[model samples]
Every structure is written in C-alpha cells, then in structure tokens.
Target: MTTTISPSRKTNEAVRPAKQPLRDRLVRLQRRIPIVQLALLVLVCAYGLATLPGFGSWMSIKSILILGALVGMAALGQSIVVLIGGIDLGVAGYIVAGALMVTQFATLNNVPFGVAFLLATAGAAVLGGTVGYLCHRFRIHSIIVTFAMGSVALGLAQLQVAGAYGGGAPVWLTQMTSPVMGTLGLPIPPLVLVWAVVIVLAALFLHRTAAGRRLLATGANPRAAELVHIRTRRVWVLAFAFSAVASVVAGVFLAGFAGNVDVTMGNPYLFESLAAVIIGGTVFGGPGDYSRTVVGVLLLTVLTTVLVGQGLTGADKQILYGLIILAAMAVYGRERRLRDQV
Candidate 1:
C-alpha cells in the first residue's frame, strides 16, 4: 500500500477528471432544458420587436397572448393524455362538436346557454371516456382508438348541424374574448385571466394532489402502479375524459374569438396542441407539467406571429411546424423514461 506510484501513473491520475454523479447530471439536464427554452423565447421576442413592425405594440402583444391562450386550452387535454403515455387525436372533433352542440342547443332547442354548455361538455366527456375505456380494455394503442373515435365524433357533429356551419357567438362570449374586455375592471380580456387561472389550477392539481401522483405513477409504469393498487385503467379513462372536456371548452372560446362557428375551425388545434406539448419538453410519461406547456404555447404563438410578419404562407408555416416538432422530439426523446430512471 505504501509503494510509490510511477511518475507517469501519477501524471495520468492527475489528468483524469471526476465523473459527475448520475443524480446531479439528471438534475442539470432538467434545469438546462427549460433555461435553454426560456432563452430561446426571449431571443425570439427581442428579434420580433426589432424587426417586425408593431411587434412591440400592446395590440400585437395582446393578440399573441389571446391566440396562445386558445392553443393552450386545447393542448390541456393533450398534455394530460400524453403524460399517461397516450395521445388524443380526437381533440379537433370534440372542439367542433362542442361548438356545434352549444349553438344548436341554444338556438334550436331554445335552451338556456348554461344548459346548452353543460349538455355539450357532458356529451364530449361521455365520448372521450368511452374511447379511454375501450383502449385500456382491449390493450390497443390510443392513437388508433382516438383517431377512429374522432372520425365518429365529427360525423355525428355534421349530422346534428345538417351541414350548416356558420353561426354568431353569443354577445357575452364574444366580450369575454375581446382585448378590451376585463375581469373585475382589470383591463385585460377575461379569457386571458381565465387562462391564467387554469394554468395555476392545473399546475397545482398535477404537482400537489394525490390524484395527480397516481396519474403520474400509472404513466411511469402501469405494472408497478397496479402492484401498489393504483387503478391504471381508471386513470386512462379519467384522463381522456378530461381531455375531451378541455378541447370542447377551447372550442367554445374559439367560436367566440372567431365570432362564428365552423366545422373545420377546430382542425388546426389537433396538430398544434400536440406540437405545443412536445415542444414544451413534456415526455410521454412522468416529469412534465402544465407550466412547461404554457411556455410551449407562448413560444409557438410568438414564432407564428413572426412568421406571419415575414409573410410566410400557410403551407410554409405548416412545414416549419413539422420541422420544429421533429427537432424537439429528437432532443427530448433521448431522455430516459421515468421507469428507467427508477
């Protein structure tokens, strides 16, 4: 033990660097991703302000926020489902259905708006829950299940409307989304405030609640979750149901924002919601939250505005979105799954 090392051996030992602990590396990676994303957000905003006309103006900024809010709302259910290792392809269908049913119920059935709203959301929840239960019971992939269900939903919605698509939103609904609209006289759109409240509530629910923990456990490893008595199937059903509800609400708000309802209006959100979740660094299981999604929503909104300012066509924008999503998945996909980490 007392033998002296050779000079070369001593030099080699001195040059060798210490390996970082695995936990430390993991924590660093978690921190680094968000920081990099935030930096990118800031850079994009600064560039927009510098180059895009009126990009720094309140009107321009408000428009971005409002658009981001709509996307964020639609992405809410996608976020929940994806957290549990599933995807919801039916969001667009639910959005359109909710929009159509709400208007039709109020106008044709002569029901109160509140009753119509309830009926529309309730119908969406039923459809979504059925999809969730079917996928879990049959051990099928959610993508297939949700896609077929979405088609069914769209078909039913079309029948309900009898092919007619245009209708004005209620005045209060429009006011809620108006830039000049305020909650409690705050001078900001009530819709934006509602979005903010949703963000807070969602963060709290996912991070601080027992049900949230169960949901995460189920997603991380269903087998392990079951061993501990967590009902994975119930989690799936509830998650998709919630997703349907969120998408429908977003549809309702979108109708107001657009001042009318159209069957195809919700189509863009199907892709955009998924894009926002992935771009926000939320993996398919565990460790992602609504806050990351909010960041993603903002990043996407700003980027789209800049692209519009640069006069990119709709097709060009779609191409860019695809590329950006690919790049994001490439980076985030390499991370170890939650079960693997365990």
Candidate 2:
C-alpha cells in the first residue's frame, strides 16, 4: 500500500493564501516609506506655536498664512509641471516679471487696478508659453530652457529697476490686498483667500479633468501618450502656462503686500517654491498630489518662520532648506524603486 498524507496536511495544502485588497496593499506600502514627515511637520508647527512668543497670536498666524499662501500657489504650479515630467526653474523670474509688469503699468501708464492685474497675468502666461514652445520645438530639456528663461526674466526685471526700486505701485492695488477681513477677532488676509482658491481649482483640475489625466499620462510616459493620440507637446505647453499663471498671481499678491515692486522681491521664492514642491511629496517627473504640496508649503512656511525667530540668517536658512530637499529626494528615490519593483 502507498503511503497516504494526513487529512490535516491535505487540508493545509488545499488552503490558498489570502490576497490583500488593493487599498490595504497601498496602505502597507505607504507605511514602509518614511511618511512621518507629515506628522513631524505638524509637531514642529505646534512646537513653534508653544515656544515662540506671539507665535500663536493672530498677527503671526496671518503673516504665516499670507506668505505661505503665495508660496503655495507657486509651488502648486511647479508641482504640476514636475508631475508632467518637466521642471520650471523660471518661477522666480516669472514672479519678478509679473510684479514688474504691474509696477511699470501703474507707475508709467496710470493703468487701473483691474487692467494692470490682467495685463500682468497675461504677460506672464505668454512668457510661460514661449518657454514651453522652445522646449518642445527644439527638443531641448525643459530644465535648461526654463533656467535660461529665468535668467532672462530676472535680467529684464533688474533692467526695469536699474538699481533702484521700480518707483511705486498704484494706490488701489496696495489697498486691496492690505486690509484684512476681520471676523470675530480673526484676520483673514486676501492672500489667504487667493491661496485657497488656487489650491481648490488646481486640485480639481488635476483630479477631475480629462486634460489633467492626459498631462499625467504624458509625464508618466510621453512616448506612450503620443502613441495614444494625446498632444504631448500641447500638454507640456499648458503645464508651463499654468506654472506661469501661478507665479504671476503670487507676484501680484506680493505687490499688494509690499506696497511696491522691487527687482529682488522674487529672488528668495525660487528656491522656496522648489523646496515646497519636493517636501510635499511631488517627486521630480513623477506622480504627486497638489493637496500634499499645500501641506508642504505650510510646513515650510512654519519652519522658516521659526528659524528666523531663532536668529538664523538667510544663508543658514537656505542651507537648511537645501538639506531638507535632499533628504526628501532620497526618501522619494527609495520609495520609487520599491513601487517599481512591486
């Protein structure tokens, strides 16, 4: 007689392994990565509020919101371009250009607030579109092209100023953004409202529109996207245009806040926007969420505020920012590899 396996052994052999749900698998994978950055950011914000005198005060909060809002808008735009497998190093340049447009209009032409804002925004968009065209038509890398464009934009702004403040902005533009909306002892800055609108609109555009999906697909695989009849070049152009719009909006807001335009107003934001995008989990030329970008911007704003309060110089802040971005990239790289393997 042949040897027979035990009933328990047969049962064990017959039992198939349970498969994890997709959602569960995603959650587990997310946990494997260093996702604690978000929590850490929250903790840091709380610490800043508790330790820094007046840090939690209304004025401090308003200041953070206003600054964060402007930076967040630009970061959102940058994140979109990055998601589409491109980079726009021209954020600061576009911002400066936008601000200068408004200042020049108001100072020289005596343009109305509405007209100046529209002209500035439209001008920035055109600049962005031109950069996109240069990249697509010449088969140049977006990064190199945008970097050069940024230099040009910066130069133009400086040329306008010619070693002095660009005169001054219109009175109405200053008044519109300065007066805070007070509700029950809380001040809501106009920049905060602008930021909220941009975030919501961007989130919707990325998640709810077919064009957005096409952009993502183009970024994920341009060759495949083109094969599928998606106008990859147009998507690229649109991405740059969107980024320019963000920069211009931010510049306009800044103009209102500062009450005038200076060539250097946008210099600091170039790196800040990049940091915010990276820290928000938007990998370079990879999938990312705008909501996360917003959170990242807020986190950065808080960190910078605390650092300044602690007497850190601008150079020190820049160094720390660079380190943080590097750390985020490292983490993202590992996670990306893991995802590819899976």
Q: TM-score each candidate.
A: 0.92, 0.86
TM-score, prediction 1: 0.92
Model number with the top TM-score: 1
Which residue pairs of candidate 2 clash? none
Q: Per-residue lDDT for 1-342 in model 1, tens only?
A: 598889999999999999999977866776445765677799999999999988998877778889999999999999999999999999999898878776754676677878878877888888899988998999999999898887777788778768667656789998988887778967678889899999999988988999999998988889899999999999999999999999989988998898878778888999999999988888887668888888989998999899899899989989988998999888777767888876
Candidate 2: what lDDT? 0.77
Lowest-sum lDDT 10-residue window in model 2 = 333-342
Which window of 10 residues has the lowest lDDT sum in candidate 1? 27-36
